[model samples]
Target: MAHQTRIPKLASILAVSALGLSLSPSWAARSFTPQAGTWVISDEVDGKPGRGFAIDVQGNTFFMQVFGYEKNGDATFYAATGQMEGDTVTAPLLRYQGGRSFGSEPRDAQEDKSIGDVKLSFRNGLQGTMQLPGEPAKDIERFIFTAPDAAYYQTEQWKTSSRMARWFGLNAQGQVEKSWFAMLKTSPTEPMRLTLSDGQTSETLECSLTTPSDSIRCVAANAADAGQAPVVKEAQFRLLGAQVAGAVSLQAEGAAPLQLLGINTRADYPYSGGVIVGCCANGLESFMPGTFGYAQRPAYQPSNGTWVMDDELTGKPGRGVSLDVQGGKMVMQVFAYRADGQPTFAMGVGDFAPDPELRDVSSARFSLQQYRGGRSVGGAASSGELVRDEGEVMVQVSGRTGGYGMPAGSLAEAMVQFPGESAKRMRRLPLQPWQTLEDQLFGEWYFPGLSYAGRPLTVTLNRREGEFVTNDDGSVRCQFNTQMLRGECQWPTATGTSGSSGPIELQDAFALSNSYVRLRDRYGNLVGLGQVPLN
Candidate 1:
């Protein structure tokens, strides 16, 4: 086993000291002077944290990047806006990305190139304030300069671990119960989901930002909760880079008052410009074997079980192995040995977390056992955390041994399960690259679809393009690249005999996808079939 490094106390910001930016000296005066470079603004409400970045240009324009999270980390909020010089900086209302706070209404047609005035003034030596659409006064925060940081400056990448609790709804007991605390990994667009141990029962939950703050609501991805009630939570803070600072928090509607969390910042090292290095903790590990998706190998032909390591199992560990277990968990074992086949390093075992990527179709679990020629090592207990996003989960493991030597062989086993009722609701996922073309071609196609009215009939999909032309007699006329086909299709209302002969009356309504073929049916009822592939 490799030696482990000593970790610093939680109170120390040494790891990300350089990544934390510093506020302008004039923050105490409540006056701000805009700078012409990259800077960060941080906020704290209740116990949550939110971060914002600004890239200023020639004293005339400034681009802003904002991010915020709820107490559970699942309520992530973020946006990008630009401001220009004027009597006062009037920024466009902020919006969220990859989050679900924005209601169903289509987003405003404003373009990113549209620049507006955004005033910047300091409030104190380390505090500042700004205004948005709904704010009565200015929103307050602290600014940090990231270029000159000691640790973050020297380190090109770093990682931090944080906890998030999703507030679904109150329980029957009236006590505020939360889903599992989720682990959040932040990197520009590549965020990692980690695990949260709640002592007794550990569960995986998704984490995201809802809004920058209660005062300035950012546009979210899904706004099903729009016009509902609000949530009350505070904001929290942590400095990550030199001259740069950040914050996180939660916002909700109804019942409770909006609560903001803790806010704090510290000085960073000098500018050591290069690349920003990311960080990771031992408690977190990836579940994907090498590249994701499917891979083909000869069936496990018994005698061909000669294990070998893939780059993914880098560092230590002997010949690597992979197996599938139905939804619970899996245990794998690896043995390290000298070239002579004599054991050197102690046997090691890895227990993988349930696979979140496939949680919808199936769940997974993993376990690792160390053995020397079929003998057990006896001291193998591993722990893992599950970072859940709607359906999938990611597991990380840590192993230990008193003094075992390397052996000649290793093995890994996995379990995949389908949680009939305990599974979380499945969120519609983004399509894969190859699926994009199909998604467009089959855009609105619906089989015995649910949204349509009246008696629904099952519809078979053939070809599709932009407009879906339906016949006056209640039939489907589909158009593909240049090919056309007719079908006596039935929607919710009427069922018709399948035939190919007809002078179809293609209607004005174009088919986005065949969910509900829009037809001016003078007297027929409508029921839509679910979507399907033409092939």
Candidate 2:
């Protein structure tokens, strides 16, 4: 017979304050928010396949849910929610039963008993330690199935951007049809590349932007290798805000030259320029980079802000959801009315996993927990306690468009299920109007060194009385007009370098966010502020 270990149940909650845990002095100088995602005991992710922990952090509030097995091999889950002190959080884990499950009638989950107090201390966003009752502390880290591709791009010093554009037109049978195009640009000087695919075959095009006309002209980049006449002889595309309008001329060996007008089916963010590109894909599909080698899929982080259902924008505004995604983890809060028309909200935190059915879609499932009996508005130090399990909510995001075009990861589709209710579809509601180029450009920023071995840079800008000025004592100063996405900046020249004394002309200025910006200097070299901490 094997000796089995069992989790002890407690009638009373442990007082964590009596533990007298000390806080780190370094954490006082900088704010460190633990990345929200699946966390597991270090080196035990594969060894313990059926057990792990999911942590969701909203501001300073940390919620953790642990899924494991009982001594008899029955599955069970424990949850704890508490405020974080510096980089540490301690709370009493609670077990609940008799809650609503799939296809069951609605019933509140009652607290069964207190398991024990659990303490979580983070060394950084990706690494941490977890201390469970009656067990030794274990090392932990964020569970990453695949590393983000953006990290690879940064390591290789390759500046890249990408976007998705839809093309709609009448087909050969005179029926309306639509297709998608993935646009990628390596650098300012590199030719713009366009990829078109139909789930099976793909085509590539090398394009250039024609000045004055402001039209993108493209030629087949892979036609000759296929031993076939180029399907696209010439293409002229003009980006109209989020919508793209263009005409493509096709050539075939046995067919006459044909011209087709193309228009997009949906609206998106305004176009900035080629520098707005990111790593080669936009979640829809991946493209071969040819010379760029294998580029991993970038981890998708939906824009941080409030999101409402698209259909509910004009009505009385009954209910809405708030979404905040950080470091690949997502925390969603759904606010709605209860049975008696009383307002209530439920929140969940989890990681977005790749969807099995849709190649371009990623979905996250959350065990929604409702908290009650906490501090009131303007009340003294008190915390909320989870009172019941509300239900489950899942959000599926696709076609993330951002980084100079819109807010990065701005658009997505979602579904919510509460207890016995069926799932409902929801789309991200666009609340704010599209920001002007000036609005995007005006902000304080911090960027890592542009050179391989240079110090980080901090930049502050303000526009006063029709003029832009840098508030910092930095060597770089730039000015630009809203009408054109071009500017001129005075930058320091390397010692013993030969160049004109005149200011360097810059173009393709794109503000991906208040903290991230990209530009191209006259020499076609890349210069921009990336997401580095200003502090």
Candidate 3:
């Protein structure tokens, strides 16, 4: 009988309303919609910030969607949608249609089954509010659509190529379990207020944004222990997107004044460009690279390798394009010849790596600047990192407004040509034919998942030789290299024992992230060691 493994589950909430407007019979015939789009989370009372929501009206009914981290202890999102009747932007707890959380997958939580009454309202057709029924204390939140995309073009962070970000709200123990994502568009003129909530206690602080040498600084609107100025008792922000500098700071004047280092989150997925991420493809549907931040193009210098053209495209800019690299950097103007012999700007991506020691030709990032009749409406960007051959770099520029985030990330795709004519354009390009992970796996790897089991395995591999040791009684030792599967092993081929190693083989050699591969036998067959890493 196969054992039943348990999967992680998320505990979260989902959500909005009020304005006294003309409720007439003609109101049903008249169309009603928001004045602006991209309503961002601006303020929250007795709740968390960084939550963005939207509203849509159809005839006598109104629909809503709430996004971002909720007050619940769950560190992930508590997104929910609802509908109201009779021209009122209000709904009972039962009116909530459906919902989903962002972190762990749903596991039949009672929180998803229970919802409190909600009151919603819009003012000037640009702002909105969501609260509990009849009372103001439950929760009152606000979102504004007219807010600009602050992380791009206009901000100091974007200008300096600091486009990547992840944030969280910390507690007094100097801990930040739940992430508090703040993608904000603040008033450059007035004081920007932030509500820091830790489930039980809350602090409201007025902050001023100052620019000194293009670096943005946030200072308390009022000095500490002096006036009505609320102090920022606790907060943890880890800005890890910069190329040269990154920090995890806890800025509480009287409390922990430590400028710390090391891992912040439990799962320390590489934050910097080192650990490439997949295409964040869940929410953002209308993203275009270079318009906002620099998009990335990952590559590995193949010594004397050259860029191949996928000229199947004959449209504007040749539909397909490949970049030329010199000294690990691309030139300003890139163009490709069309079928008619006319040259047009070519833009696309590829992946290949030589050695990090010789020349780090592993990745290249770019940003697209979009223009409509020479006027800039808004923009978005992408990133291309060193990915395996199943090989793809899922570049989803994350945001709150305009549905920038989803279960995976945001989804916005564009096709670019690669090396061969058969190699078509794809935003998520996989260089499976050119991937090399043999050198990357040259160190010692311990199987953490198997530590608790009866026999834990310790694997040590190198370019020339390797060994697998069973820690239990130190009873087993298997030495194998690129040429041979098993150099030596105790109790080999005995009843109920591990099989005899044979000619070395590694299945799906490129997908190491999938963990432990099939370890075959002398005649090249499964040794029951498959799924060993995660098993």
Please give the clash total of every predicted structure, in order: 160, 6, 29
Candidate 1 lDDT over 364-404, as tens digits, reads: 23222111221111112111111221222212211111011
- Tell me, by lDDT, which candidate is best: 2
The TM-score-based order of candidates, best leading, equals 2, 3, 1
* Pairs of residues at least 3 apart in sequence or in different chains that clash in candidate 2: 160-277, 160-278, 161-277, 161-278, 162-277, 162-278
Per-residue lDDT, model 2, residue 145, is 31
User: How do the predictions measure up, each by TM-score?
Assistant: 0.19, 0.37, 0.24
Better of 1 and 2 by lDDT: 2
Candidate 3 TM-score over all chains jointly: 0.24
Candidate 2 to truth, TM: 0.37
**Tens-digit per-residue lDDT, 474-535, candidate 3:** 44344434432113333334366655433222211211111222222111111111110100
> How accurate locally, in lDDT, is each candidate?
0.22, 0.42, 0.25
lDDT of 2 by residue, 407-449 (tens): 2233344544445666655544322122343333334433322
